[model samples]
Target: MPTALKLTTVQGNSLPIPGVESWHVTAKDPAMLVMTDFHWHSSVTVSENSTIDAALDHMKHTGVRCAFVIDGKMSAVVGMITAYDISGEKPVQHMRLTSTPRNEILVKDIMQKMADWHVANLKDIESATVAEVLKVFTDSDVTHIPVMEKNANNEQRLRGLLSFAKVKRLLVA
Candidate 1:
């Protein structure tokens, strides 16, 4: 039978790891790695009330794959529309070909709700090693994860985004 081992965090917090010794000391932990800094791409935000057509135009202008849906001070990720989502069916072509204006289709009509999507906060992500993060990307259906920073008031604010492609590059490097 394989022997189990216990791991601890930098603060001597015990972590559960089966059949592994000093698991916290492994390369998977960010604390053990030399690279502590993580980079993020600028966030593309849109109002939940905005039309899908408008959102698409904004996405094209920004050249980003996803956009966060915001409503006043209460911001939550509504849904993410990727190039593939807009492509394949060629909605743009159909819109242009038809007389229907783009503004008619609201983002709420198309955006996936927060409850329906897989989301992770910075604190939840910070504990993960690069390999672990990569695993999340591979295992999950989502391609992008929004990174949030806690403000002085203890409110989570969307700071930036982490892309699976970028994480993959870092891992390979």
Candidate 2:
């Protein structure tokens, strides 16, 4: 009061509160990270009968690590192909089982069979936290799960995908 009344001598007007040291969000943090295909997906696909070379080429062209395999002209997805499958000789191994040449291998050969593929429901995903999504990855062998959502007609259709790629990238970093 004496200093202020006599002269303009205020040292600091703001409280000594802590300021943000860094503003970065990582996957390991407990974030309410609800996500879907609409969040970060850019995609490409191949027919089940499409050649592995073609699938690989498609991946290369589109900068996608994976591609979905669709059934004959139907919008139904039959399987999926990933860079790991190609490099790990999975397609060649599948071809070997059927006595097919390596060059002739197709998406159907190495693709994760629809019966074996794991999937998630959009409704459940909507409320699931990032931790839960990470648990899904930790609890399953599948690297990705296609998400299905109910349409206006109440028919469930492919709407999104959750991949281990994000978890891998984050954890590794």
Candidate 3:
């Protein structure tokens, strides 16, 4: 026979939560300044078939400048869309080329395909400084870039994203 264990009454109604500490970051600091680690955060995503306006609206609502494009079942990332891609000349170019109205243009029409995306290895990013990552943003002339890592199966997967806008916000101007 097992003996009954004593239970203690709850002391407080509130539970402790993780605290966010603000830090002054320099270029020489860790590249965590701009990284949106998916391990700890959710990635904003949209469907490829969604309208450009819809995608832009979602991004705006989420206060994000970019979103990952997902497949039909929302299973995998198929591409990426940025506020610039929707608001820039790409929309107009697509409208003129395909004779499709602006409203009819879909995210897939303007989003950069995943296969064409330039990515950084997670290992490199792990040891990189803010300035080094910033150099990549400058050299690539891109506001965002995905960081990739290999799984136990040896297949590449998205680990996180680095955003120049985030970097500017965290580092001293």
Which candidate wins on lDDT? 3
In candidate 2, position 60 carries an lDDT of: 89
Misplaced by over 4 Å in model 3 are: 1-23
How many angstroms is residue 89 displaced in model 3 relative to the true structure, after the best TM-score fit?
A: 0.8
RMSD of each: 13.8, 10.8, 4.6
**Candidate 1 C-alpha lDDT tens digits along 1-173:** 88799896576667668734432233365621312223433567787777776777888898766777776455555556554545434456556666555557556655656666565666766676777767777888767765666889998666556666555544533
The positional error of residue 118 in candidate 3, measured at the CA in angstroms, is 0.8
- Residues 3-111, model 3: lDDT tens digits: 8998989788976665555655789998865689998889999999999999999999998998999988879999999999899999999999999999999999999
Candidate 1 Cα misplacement greater than 4 A, ranges: 1-42, 72-80, 88-103, 149-154, 169-173
Where does candidate 3 have its weakest 10-residue lDDT segment? 15-24
Q: After aligning candidate 2 to the native by TM-score, how far in Å is the CA of 101 from where it should be?
A: 1.6
TM-score (C-alpha) between model 3 and the true structure: 0.86
lDDT of each candidate versus the true structure: 0.61, 0.72, 0.89
Q: What lDDT score goes with residue 27 in model 3?
A: 91
Pairs that clash in candidate 2:
none
lDDT of 3 at 170: 82
Instruction: Rank all candidate structures by their TM-score, best first, as comma-separated numbers.
Output: 3, 2, 1
Task: Give the Å error, residue 88, model 2.
Answer: 2.3
lDDT of 2: 0.72
Residue 15 error, candidate 1, Å: 47
